[model samples]
Target: MGDDLPPDLARLRVLETWAAHYLTRIRARIAAVERQQAQQQTPAPTAAPPSRPGTGPGRARTPDWGLAEAGIGVPTTEIHRGDCWARGKTLVPVSAERARAELADGTQPCAVCRPDRVLNRLGSS
Candidate 1:
């Protein structure tokens, strides 16, 4: 019985040693992965430039020359690039022909860009 106990104890010690080695290897692999992730991380932008007006997310500074209908069901109006003062309005892009047609259909051209002048140029050309 004493002899059997020594063999069992030896086996238990071997298992413990194997588990420790496995755990050490796992920890080393995890550390290596963490270091790699850190190296791959992009550095934060240094001294971001001052944001321009109307340049925030989902806001267009220079929108395409087109007709814009207010998302809140306002009448569709001719809008020029960079001239819309109405915030939270979704502007849909249209062609010059469409702009002219829209104006003829009672859609007002943007007072700022004067898209009517563009329509006149298109007519002359």
Candidate 2:
């Protein structure tokens, strides 16, 4: 009223300042979303499916073979077939002969994919 702001007017000014700040933040967020929409990207290319006769999440497919590692300095624990979704950390690709040998040596075939059954049915190599 006379170089001194009234209490109600001061409160209104504080609220207006807060609203302006919030509006600015909301505008910035909206702009970011708009920019993202304007620059939409194509999805990454997918790899071709496995070339096996069978089809499923688990089957003879890409990778073909691999060894499931137990841990650092520990012996490899399990052998898994290609496309076995439940395989743990794969240490290396295993050959058919190696998979057969390992399974015979008690390296424990992956229970989920039943690599032993696949190997047994496939028969040597």
Name every residue pair that clashes in candidate 1.
none
Candidate 1, overall lDDT? Answer: 0.61
**In candidate 2, what are the lDDT values of residues 31-98, reduced to their tens digit?**
67866975796546669854454456675345787788775322348888866655543446789889
Best by lDDT: 2
Question: Across residues 1-125, which tens digit of lDDT does each residue of candidate 1 receive?
Answer: 55543467688677666765565466567767877997999867869875665587996665546566643333344555534443124567676677777778877776546778877688778
State the weakest 10-residue window (summed lDDT) of model 1: 80-89
Query: Which regions of candidate 2 deviate over 4 angstroms?
Result: 1-61, 72-76
Number of backbone collisions per candidate, in order?
0, 0
Best by TM-score: 2
Model 1 segments more than 4 A misplaced: 1-63, 71-76, 82-88
Residue 1 lDDT in model 1? 50
Each model's C-alpha lDDT? 0.61, 0.70
